[model samples]
Target: MVSVTENTEQKIIDAACKVFIQKGMDGARMQEIADEADINKALLHYYFRSKSKLFDRVFVEIFSDIVKLLGEEINHSTEIIELIERMVNNYIHLIRERPFVPDFVLHELNRHPQLIVQQIHQYGMDFSKFQLLIDEGVLNNKIHYIQPVHLIVNVLSMCIFPFVAKPIIMGFMLNGDEAKYNQFIDERAGHVVSFIKSSLLINNPE
Candidate 1:
């Protein structure tokens, strides 16, 4: 059986996520969140104390999940290509299920970049594994000598931009066909992997 606090905390978090997604941090109202949670504002305060505190918890939880999937763990694996492919596939699958997450994060990051940086440091993440992978690939002649950060940024940009721009892409480009829009997003993972492989593959020696 779930504890009362656990149940109420989840309800508050869920309600806050929706409210933040809809109104953004600046525009979100405490009363609106309380109403959405079906609880009074006093209870909301008893649980979270302040809107900023609640927002921090929500953002940290969501951001930590994304960082774990996209940043920290992927770099720790030796099979860099396989890791990238898996991360892309998993991330696309998750975004398909929770499409609002990316936009919500971006909105908050725009409002407070330091929060993200602080959370990343707090999690003790280092990209050294990714750097080592790049070094190994270069030494083995499997990839050209380029900065790993650039490669990572490119890969992440390719994977994330479509989702970020989904509204405009679906409206203007796909004529608002939800099926076509989803299909396009579903195809992006494979397309991104293929592009990376093509860029990284070694040339045959004569």
Candidate 2:
């Protein structure tokens, strides 16, 4: 049996997510969140003392999930290609289930860039695990000796930027055909992998 407090807390969190996505952090109102949760403002306050606190909770949760999905574990794993494949697939599924999450996260990130680095440190996330992978690739002459951060940024940009820029791409590039937009996103996953592989795989010079 769930306690009333637990249930109410969850309702508040859910409502906060919706309101944050729709109105952004600055624009969202406690009253709007309360109405969305179908609860009174006092109850909302009881669960979350302030809007900033509530937004921090949501931001941390969302940021942690994204980092976990894209962190060193995936970069350091022996089966990195397989890990990348699974991540792409899983991310796509998650996007399908929560289409608003990407836009919401990006909006918050634009509003508060430092929050991302702060959250990364708070989560104890470091990309050093990729150091070995990068070193091995360069040693074997498989890839250029570029900083791992650059590689990470490249891969993440390739994976996430399409979704982030979907509206512009669809509106101008694809003329706003919903199906075509989806197809473009679907193709991006494989294209990202292919691009990474091509960039990393070595060719013997004569």
Worst window of 10 by summed lDDT in candidate 2: 75-84
* Candidate whose lDDT is highest: 1
**C-alpha local distance difference test of each model:** 0.80, 0.74
Tens digits of per-residue lDDT, candidate 2, 58-96, equal: 777766776776664465475444545666666765565
| Candidate 2 lDDT score relative to the true structure | 0.74
lDDT of 1 by residue, 91-127 (tens): 7887777777888898789878877777867777677
Instruction: Note each model's CA RMSD in angstroms.
Output: 3.2, 3.7
